[model samples]
Target: MIKKHLIYKKDKWNMLTVEVNGKTLILREISDQWGEECHTFLSRPAMMHWVEERFPKEQFEGSEEEWTAIMQAFKEV
Candidate 1:
């Protein structure tokens, strides 16, 4: 089963971790201009930030489904 856990606490954001099979992922909440959480806004610069931090190893030459899955993973929490 996939397990997501709170790894750290912060004033304006949080650090979360998810483990599945033999792999792990770290995620963070993305906020908007008003500090509202917005996930899956691929057209926004925030998405660039998320990609840079969350999936830095990704080559960005894969299918869109890959990105969707990553974003959905964070949203599922």
Candidate 2:
């Protein structure tokens, strides 16, 4: 089963953390930039870096496991 959790949402931009077949991914949609930008991240560090750079921690909305997965990536670096 595929599980999707919305981590953040705002004008023309939103992010989703998805779990599928035991793998995790971060997906983003940014309609405000260049007519629309879609991104997918499987790398933990990449996910952590992008989220840390753009969104606030308090804005995240997801399960503890999902949040921990992202933070664990940050700590691994």
lDDT of each: 0.46, 0.53
Model 2 clash pairs are none
Q: What is the TM-score of each candidate against the true structure?
A: 0.29, 0.41
RMSD of each: 11.7, 7.5
For residues 1-77, write the lDDT of model 2, one tens digit per residue. 66555443455354334333345554544444545454567675676677676545666676676666666544443
lDDT of 2 at 34: 46
Off by over 4 Å in 2: 10-21, 30-36, 56-77
lDDT of 1 by residue, 1-77 (tens): 65544432344443334333234343344333334332434233444476567565466544777656655644554
Candidate 2 has an lDDT of 0.53
Error of 2 at 73 (Å): 14
Residue pairs in clash, model 1:
none
